[model samples]
Target: MGQVREGTTWLSVIWRVCNVFMSLFFALATYVQINDPDAGMWMVGYGVPSVLCALISWKPLVSEHLAWRRVADLHVMISSSVVIMLGWRIHKEQITQIFQQEEGREFFGLLLTSMWLLLCRHSGRSAVGKLRVFTAVAITLFPFITWFYYHVNKELRSEWPSHCKTAI
Candidate 1:
């Protein structure tokens, strides 16, 4: 029992570390998205960590010896995948232009959906619970929040007109 507890604690620490890295990555990506639409390379900074966390978390998640951690790790994996996919889409020239042409409205919508999915994964209940409610609220307000930010950021406004529309 003691050994199991210790292992669980260690896994939890790793999970928390991954979360911290993810938060930083997101912050950096958001800054880049808002300030430097041309700096598509910045997406890799967040993508790499998100993929690494998902991969590292996979081992414990699949181990029969650590069922609880496995479930938690699965959530992390899903979250990471969502982030990676979104990042990839944003970095692609064609997709990125589509997003920019639309004034980031679609991009923000997708981001909100992904975030809500992530929140659902984190929300402790295996089934429906408060987390679901929170996800609902997030999904509902995601577009509005994104639009608000888009309007507030001058860089977003100025760059849209001159950005390339060529599909990747």
Candidate 2:
């Protein structure tokens, strides 16, 4: 029983740390959208998750609030819809390197936000599982690594819209 408690405590710490990282990533995502034509829409898309994740990191129990769940759910629904549309667009365009194009990037941003929100749902009520911690680490790392890859390899972003080139 004591061992289980210790493990849960450790995993909860990891969950909080990962949420902090993800919040920052989403916040950065929101900032970079300043140059986008549809900046406001994209900003809200990323901003909500940024704030929610921040709340979770600050107080894990925030996830248990009805208001928080409703807001997160609404965002998830909207993000999922956008993800489907973006997926179709990517498919139609035959976009193999999704990070290179604007819509491709948008697709990923929304998808990540949606996924993380779903993962966080009801997480405050119990100890975060090992799988959730591992997933949180991956989710926290992916965007930053992908962004760095694009930032370093300018050639990969050669075909990107002018606005997309300015932020990173």
Candidate 3:
């Protein structure tokens, strides 16, 4: 019992330390994106919410004084959704504009980045829970990713989407 308490206390301290850095990281990202003219509305719009989510989810005082796990889960889900939507909207532009990546490397990086977007979520101890999270993410993201790839293909049908219409 004492050992469990000690370990939990140590983990809480570590979480607090991590919270500080994560808050800073998200804040910086938010500020930079908001100030960047070329980042597009989608990116800039989600920036503030992202920082708020990060700060609220990880702040020890907020967590301790409130329904910590519920709040954390809610914020994490919102932040992850924002990230995935932004990625879906701009994945093509990013893949094309980024530093020289030989051929297939860009898509590989995109896949990895998409997978890593939800690492903050403590997806529970059960395999079913973890699998559910991954499955949900995949289901939500796969369509956009597939659309992106298909649209990018040189031989994709010209009838796919009209240039006059935005993808929404």
Which candidate gets the maximum TM-score versus the true structure? 2
lDDT of 3 at 56: 38
lDDT of each residue in 1-168, candidate 3, tens digit only? 897777655555444444344444434434444334344543433343345335534653443333545645554555456556545645755655322232232233333323323343442222223344345445435434654675576354343233212332
**Regions of model 2 farther than 4 Å from truth:** none
- Which numbered prediction scores highest in lDDT against the true structure? 2
The deviation in Å at residue 150 for candidate 3 is 30
**Cα-based TM-score, every candidate:** 0.31, 0.95, 0.38
- Best first by TM-score, ranked: 2, 3, 1
- Regions of candidate 3 where Cα sits further than 4 Å from its true position: 38-61, 64-168
Worst 10 residues of 2 by lDDT: 97-106
TM-score of 2: 0.95
Q: Which digits, one per residue and each the tens of the lDDT, describe model 1 over residues 1-168?
A: 897777656545545444444444444444544344644544443444344334434532322334434554554465456556666666664464444654243344335434533443432322233334444444444444555586577576565544322210
Q: How many backbone clashes does candidate 2 have?
A: 0
Model 1 misplacement above 4 A: 36-120, 123-168
Error of 3 at 20 (Å): 0.7
